[model samples]
Target chain A: MEPGMISLAGGNPDLAGLPLDALGDAASALIREHGTEVLQYSTGAGIDELRTELTRVMARAGIEADPADLLVTAGSQMALELITAMYCDPGDVVLAEGPSYVGAISTFMGLEAEVSHVPCDADGIVPDALEARIAELRAAGKRVKLLYTIPNFNNPSGITLAADRRPRIAEICREAGIVLVEDDPYGLVRFEGETVPAIRAADPSVIYLGSLSKIFSPGIRIGWVLAPREVRDRLQLLSESTTIHASTLSQHLALTYLRDFDWSGHLDRAIVRYRERAEALLEALPSALPAGSTWTRPSGGFFVWATLPEGASADELFALAAEEGVVFIPGSGFYADGQGERELRFSFSLESPERIREGMTRLARASERYARR
Target chain B: MEPGMISLAGGNPDLAGLPLDALGDAASALIREHGTEVLQYSTGAGIDELRTELTRVMARAGIEADPADLLVTAGSQMALELITAMYCDPGDVVLAEGPSYVGAISTFMGLEAEVSHVPCDADGIVPDALEARIAELRAAGKRVKLLYTIPNFNNPSGITLAADRRPRIAEICREAGIVLVEDDPYGLVRFEGETVPAIRAADPSVIYLGSLSKIFSPGIRIGWVLAPREVRDRLQLLSESTTIHASTLSQHLALTYLRDFDWSGHLDRAIVRYRERAEALLEALPSALPAGSTWTRPSGGFFVWATLPEGASADELFALAAEEGVVFIPGSGFYADGQGERELRFSFSLESPERIREGMTRLARASERYARR
Candidate 1:
């Protein structure tokens, strides 16, 4: 972005909300107490403390997995790549929601896998639609390797998978013998939604990816996959040959922060803070957006998906958006087949309430200018 | 390894040899001074300070590259993978030294690229042989993609390419239009060898990989690649989508440490420490090993590559050595085609002098046992 542009594109954590003092205290304590181990090369999955903590955290989301089954990654993206590599050979069909996280889509394509999107409504993935699509793909003799999803607060759409659909989708994948990757990076970030049982809890076969990036810190680049032993073994081998495990200092920092920091207190504060910002965006949307524009009423998470007027594509207005000094991810960038032509995702992760309002006002003027043209 | 077993297998910085105190100071200072920015999502190629520092360090090796040409990675392994991904399509031929790092081999194979071996001698890859092989492959209608070589203290083989041959190989590679990957992770770890110009110094087209793992610390997983703008751009995209920029905290830690720490002084201590360990292993080898065994006299880096007696296989003695409570990597593990049958690599990086001597004696006994059979 240019110096004066207002960025509503990035889905990063709250910059001002980062626990600076706690992290410093943790770092100092960790280095003073376990400096050698933290700084030296580490082996065998990762630091045990981080893995164990992830397991406990997963339990809060209704996921029960042995710490032994979890493998640490550079981030959930690495875990996604690992799973993509392990399951699909090139050209094998991998499924995801219609508009998925661009990063995941990139990983699937980067590994040369064919990504086929299953359409979704407001409440995340529609189970019937997913089952029908799976059956249709099977009938067409396409090998559906895995189903990738961001069920809780899905990245761009900001829609939580309906509570009832979770188990049904799990059953469908299990019966179809297709692996499900439940990437729930934004699960614990919610402020108003009720916690739903994870697909992993419904079916132990699902590969669950969790990250501290959304909640704790992305700077650490720490995330983990709760996968079956076979998948875990493959990921471990890939890791051993690639990054050779997550940054040891990061694993140490995360573990120390997890153990010593007030996690619940920090998360509670985040929920209240994000909720206020989200509300501000939600409240401003109706007035600031053009009449035909519609967006999700997301209870939590980083973004709110907005659909522009019927014939107006976000791609066409991107230049105008830049001219108006507003920046957000164009919806077409999120699509697998370039289908999100009339949509854009506005991230509410970074800016304060007033800044978010100001950005939305700029976006509104950009939209008006596009409409006039 | 078992509790009582002595290991001469690990190719890592010594546990006690790491600069923990300096790193701790850096971490504390960074988090205190620049917490939010350090913790926030960083844009661009990498931490600017680290990239600039890499520039000065590369200059020390008689190589000149702008910071823009550099892309920091999780490790040199990731740099290798990124280069492999950027240059070669699946089934494209990637040539490597006969006994290159197994990690690189795995990465190439994992990406479904065809890996072919070019034989090397005590002074690293024979320039004439490399030229001949490229011609043979090109004549056979094989698409010669890249030549991957660890010219500085080559892993597993411990052979540095002779200074005079560096320019020759560079010229040959340039003439063949085959890009060269000069992995120099261990360049700064040198203790005894005269400083030699990097192959990249001769050919700016070469993609040079350097790591702080051997010299600074491995646990941070900091490595970088200096390449042309196009290759660097691809790496940037991969980094953006994959691990999300090599752990922002690690990058910050590295940048801060580079600016604040007594880097050269720390490197000097590391050299003296590793040299002592290498000397200890080198001195014990002649007396402890059976006649006919010869090892490369590595002036620097971790491993001492030992060639077993002709017609005898190190694979045959591995079990005996395990029973004898001594551990080292078998040479076959490093080979692409399992051609290092009558060889083994003894890493003198982890263990102390007395411990290394003890392990060597056990290896001698195990060798004597295997040779007797």
Candidate 2:
């Protein structure tokens, strides 16, 4: 795609928001200081410095975790894969939000786990729906291994679970004896509202995933998992047999970047920039949509989920929009049974406010063309 | 683990022999030219430039792989794990060399594959013994999904498959309709003698693993898998659900490093350095070993495999050696049946000649203590 092409297909950070200069500085410093060790086989868990720093980051986020409980992975995708391998046997049921991260859905499927979608509204997965599904599966003699959630700023849907729901869900998971997988790659990208307590704080049984991809850069591929000791140990064993460890150079560079750079300041700047873009898209939605169409207003994260009027398919709209030099991910791709035919996900992270407005104008034209037909 | 500690446990490239200065130059140029793309998610397969370069590297090693048939992974470990997931279901039998890379063994076990060991002699897996085992398993109505081998300078054993035996093994696997997984991490590390053609070259059914870890650096964690188109496609699907892809920064850095740096010259220098250390260990072994004990004289690679006399356990020896600040991996850890009681693996990659001699002296002391007990 061209530079002017406004794309909502990628789950990428704003390129203009990346601290490119800091990354260059960190890379240079890492090679100069730890070149010998950076080029060698590191500990199977990850570099100690990165893990330690990650532990501190999690603590500040109200998730009390020891560095020992963290396993720095290639990305949150690997973290999910490792957890899936450890907990899910073939045919085991994994309950997840109706519209979840496509990558996580595929990972569970690849392991032969039966992924059952739990219904969600604007506030993420409904607790009653989750409980009903679990009870239904249990009564049928099916084993539900994990309850996967993107509690804060969920992907594709861009919905965050209400603060009151966190404890209720945690309690239900505890009662059901199922692990809760809290994937929060975009938790730090808050644009408004007070910070809610993570699911991990509501219960120790939650497996929390954190990533540098959203706040820093995705190219480094650095992510971490915070779980209970048993899960951490099992994941470490699996990691030893997987990639052995995350890249030592990447880990070291991340450590240097975190240590020498003002990460919180960077994140604050990113949130402000993203919030402005998100607001611009929201403001343009009325003129860009059909009379009965609707869209989500997410408090944080990269995506804005939209649902078209009846009889309008987002998949068809995506093709039409592409013809106008724009791209988007059809929301059906994020659903388990491909049921979100009328919905679409638009990423506001990559493009600026001006481009997002233009992209929406193009999308509006395409939608009108399809609606007229 | 001091700076000058005679570290014989590391599976790393010789840092002194690494083209560090050239890598620095490449890093600067890479940032100046393609900083933006390098710090972005390129593709799940890999950067195109690196894949093309790897194809040439594989071709030179006698494995004619099309770039399309390859998927760059986080490391050789990831390649093995992904391939295992693709071919073997839970409880399926996977035939592996008797004393294999522990990491690969663990990966197969983690996937719940029933791993059975095929007996091997000094020159690697004995073809007759392998055939006999296959026949016995077949008669019992058991299916062998794949046979995994390190045909060139096998880890832990430091034994290469004899040239004549390679084709025979490949033919047997082909006829038996079992996949041959040719893991050649040490292929280019040959310090002496002619390089044997990879088993993959002789059998199109064989899946090949190539790594930049041994020859270039391990910290980058970049490796490639050359499999049949079907298998490669499956791995791509699998990778999409796992780490997404290897680090883009690492891939870009590697491409630049490979293109601009004199990797062949660096490898030559590494071989000479490691050979000197290997020779020093060999010269000291006679004095260090007890009567009836022997060690393999490896032509290349990081390790030297030693066998104590019958009734002498390597685990017991390792315990004593650890107290004296010397460590070696017990051979039993590499065996499927945990039967290598008298064997041990010593690495020569990390130590200098003088350090190797000193570590050998410490090991001798530990051996004497074990023998007396």
Candidate 3:
């Protein structure tokens, strides 16, 4: 199917939200000044300029980090894979949120790690539940290698971890001596919430992932990892044997963009725009959803998670909605056990308010038809 | 140490040889046309236009391939890792030349694969030694997964496989039901010799790896794999879970560079420049080399392989040469068993003729000091 034939299935930024002109200027300047070195093989760690910029960015988030602690990867996905390879042996236990990012689940599974789930609430993974799961796994004699989380505006769930819960969660993992893999691709996205401290700030053992794809562009594939020196060295060595380094040209261009442009202002505009479209979806949901349906009102980021009447299959709804000229990802695909049959996730990030209204209208018709049947 | 402190230690392109002006123009055009998309997350299979262009390029090398059979990776290094993960199980036997690309060797080792070496001559891996090694492993009931080779202008050896050996090597792998991974980063670099058909042409099971770094730019981190459909699909899945894809910005820029620019002409200039540098290094060798020391006269690529006198350590020589303001990679680092202690690899690609001569002179003095010790 054509990618544009969708309202909620795609994980893309609103095209209108990107700072196109600023990026164009940055690219031009990058080529004009550093074209030669930018086109050559760089150090495996990353371009130093980008690293330094990212360090300052992390500092603003309350995480005390240095360029030496960072290894700019192709994306957060690569960071996850490299971490898995470095930490998990075959049959190692990897714990994650019950309904997590499909990419993260797939990455750990591909490395042959046994992925176990920790149930999450409206405010992200339940700290007590996660601790219990870790305890149970230890009692069963399984070595838990790491716990993966997306604390800020997580995929599928679209829920942020509460500020109060962050430290307790970090403390639990630290006490258990398990590394926390914190993937925060959407932390900067502020539709209607106060910023919270990162898990890395609460615990130095946390391996934090950040991406330019969510706030800027997904195509560039620039992401980074902030971790301890030991973990950083292992990731660097593994990356040296993999891609060698993130694209030098991309790094240079990104560094130029960060330096020469007002990124905070750009992100503010993006947040305002996305919030407007998200509000449009929320306003239309009452008439569109079937009886006994419930959905989370996300404060920020891209998705709205919806649950249908009991026994109403999200996969079936997806097919019916597609036939009615709307599309959404079935929530079951996001679960580790593939059991979210009655749920669906709608993304308002890529569509405008008018298109989202049209999509939800079609979705309402499909839901009415399915309920009648 | 500063990257080009002396000479040959790094895998760098000759700055003077790079098509700097053309690259700058290409970068400018790329940003002007696709700045937003370049900064976004790209498809896991890679940018389609770049894949199509690479398909045509591979065809010119006599490997009849489709874009579907190609996967644009971060670099040839990522290709090696993906292939290793796709085909190898722990304890699998992976065969390669005794002295091979250390990066490839390290990747397989990281996967816990038992690496067995096949001896090589000046013209690359000896067919008889390869067959014997395969026979010994098979007799021992070991499952041989793949034979990794750099058939054209191999690293650390600076030797190209003879034209007649291609089919013979292919047939042996075919009959043994083992896959052949043909990594040819330096294949397009023909300084003086006629080009030979790739082993992929002789056997359908052979996997071919190509890089744009040597010819265009390494900073982009664009390389590709041409393999069977099954293997290609597996790599695609692995890539999906790995970095997601190579950098979208780099891929788009590379496509623009290949499609809108004169890549063939650029390559022609690179070959000419490398040839002149290679000749200069060859001419300077006589005055610098000790009696009993010898070097390979490479037809193409960046490195010149030199064997010092028996009982002389290349490690000691490297240290002495560095003291004298010359640097080269001690050849033992390239070997699997640390047996190439008497050899050194001098890269002629990144240095000027004058620098090459000066470096060789320093190396000669170091060699005499080591010989006496």
Candidate 4:
């Protein structure tokens, strides 16, 4: 991006809110105190202390997980990749929410799995739509093997699956014999509303992916997968066969932060900052967006899913926005098929409230020029 | 392992040799001074500074690499997986040394690729054997896609590919249209002889995998792949789609170590320690084995490959050895086909010379019991 550009593109959390000094001290103490453990090769299943601690981390979301059934990963992305690799044979179908996490879509495609979209509404993946998509794919001779969802606030769209629908979605997948993969990176970064029990809480068989990236640090690249014994065994084997294990130092750092620091307090302050940024962006959208444009009002999470006026290309708008010193991700890349061309995502996670307002002003000017074009 | 068990199984480096106090200070300062850069999600291609620094690391082995063509991975293991995933379709053939790295063999099989072994002798994979295997596989209608090798002191076998044979091996793979992947984690861990030129140095097209695990620390989980441009681009995409990136803190730690620390000096001391351990194992081997047993004398790297008496089962010996309070990896796990039942790998990397000597004595006792049985 150019120097003058105001990027509403990145989905990265604000690291400025992290307690760097405390974290640094913890990192130093960890390596100094336990150099052998921290700097040596660890088990493929991950460090036992972290795995046990992660059960406590999951308990916050009402998900009961056994340490034995948990595998530490490089991040939640690795967890998703492993699950997709295990379940999907070439040409096998993976059902995902329309406007699903792009990384998941890419992973499935990269592994040669066919990703089919299950239409989602403001409240997140619609159960009826999911069932219909699965049936349609199966009727068409596609083997639907897995359903990937973000039960908490999702990437790009920032739509959280309604609490009432969680168990229903899990049951539907269970009946279909489809493995439900729940990626809940943003589960703890809520701005409003009560904590929705994770889909994994309702279904013991769900392959739950949890990450420290949002709550703690992505730099450590620590995440965990909670799954049934059979699935966990295979994932563990895959993890062992490939990367061997996640970074030992990274796992240790995460364990230290979780054990010694008031991570909850840090998360609370971050949520407040994000809430202010979101409010600033939402407040400006009315004057900034073009006529007939619409967008999701995210209660919690990093992004606002916005739709362009009908027949308008968000790709073109992106170019125009860049010219006006504002930028965002065009939505076409998020879809399995060439859908969502008239949509885009604005992230309110990285910038301050003032910068967000300034970005909105630039976006309004860009929209005006785009309307003329 | 049991408390009394003397394990010669682990291939981990000695972390006690590392300057923990200095490393801890550096790690602390890294996050404190550059928290945003160190703690946030980074590019899948890896940080530019580290990529640039890795070129210098490769230069030690006479391999010239461009930073643009280099990718930072979780370890060489991840690099191997990405390459395999890209090149091998299900049922596609991958050729490896008869007794290859167990991790690589497992990775190939896990990705649904068919692994075929090319026989190897003291000087590493025989060129004629490799040629014969490729011809035989091609005639059998197999789609051979990749040739995986460790041209340095190979894992388990501890056999380095003769410097003269390196170019010939590259040529053979090139002619067969197979991508040659060189995993050289121990290229710099030589105890004797001049540093051999890497196969990548002889053939720029060879996809070279380098790791800091052996020389620095596996706990940090840093490795790099220097590949051709097209391959690197796809790898970068696959990396971005899956794990997103290597750990940012890990990457920064690696960069800091390379830039500021006396890493080469540390490696020299480590090599001296490993040499002493290797000597202890080699010196004790004659009395430690069955009458007709044979083993390789490694000039560098971790393991000493040994063959038991004719028709003796290494797995059964493993059981007996465990009863004698000693452990080693049976060679069957390192082979694609079940051909190494009489062989085993004794790793001298982790234990001290005195412990190695004691481990050898216990192994001798185990062999006697196995012979009696």
Best by lDDT: 4
TM-score for every candidate vs. truth? 0.96, 0.97, 0.97, 0.98
Worst 10 residues of 3 chain B by lDDT: B14-23
Taken over the whole model, the C-alpha lDDT of each candidate is 0.84, 0.85, 0.84, 0.90
In model 2, what are the clashing residue pairs, if there are any?
Answer: none
Q: DockQ of every model listed?
A: 0.68, 0.65, 0.67, 0.84
Candidate 4 lDDT, tens digit per residue, B1-373? 7898888998999889888988899899999999988999888899999999999999999978889999999888988998998888889999998789989998899788999988888998899889999999999999999999987888889999998888889999999999999999999999999999999997989999999999889988899899999999999898776678899998998998899999999999999999999999999989988889999988899988999888889999899889988899999999988889999999999898998899889989988887799
lDDT digits (tens) for residues B317-352 of candidate 2: 887877776777888888867778888888888778
Error of 3 at B89 (Å): 2.3
On a 0 to 100 scale, what is the lDDT of residue B118 in model 1?
89
Task: Write one digit per residue (lDDT tens) for candidate 2, span A94-173.
Answer: 99887888999888887889989998888878899899999999999999999999888899888999988999999999
DockQ score, prediction 2: 0.65
Better of 1 and 2 by TM-score: 2
CAPRI grade of model 1: medium
Question: What TM-score does prediction 1 earn?
Answer: 0.96
Q: List the residue pairs that clash in candidate 1.
A: none
Q: Taking the tens digit of each residue's C-alpha lDDT, what string does model 3 give over A1-373?
A: 6554656788788656556665666666666667677777889899888999988777656788878999999887899999998888889999988678899988888888988988889888888998889989999999998999988878888888898899988898889988899998888886885788798986888999988887766777789999999989989988889989988878877787677678777888989988998899999988887878999888888988899888888888888889888898888778767778998889899788898998889989988988888
The CA-based lDDT of model 3 is what?
Answer: 0.84
Candidate 3 is scored at a TM of 0.97
On a 0 to 1 TM-score scale, where does candidate 4 land against the true structure? Answer: 0.98
lDDT of 4 by residue, A128-224 (tens): 8888888888889999999888867788788999999988899999999999999998998899989999999878989999999888888788999
lDDT of 2 at B233: 89
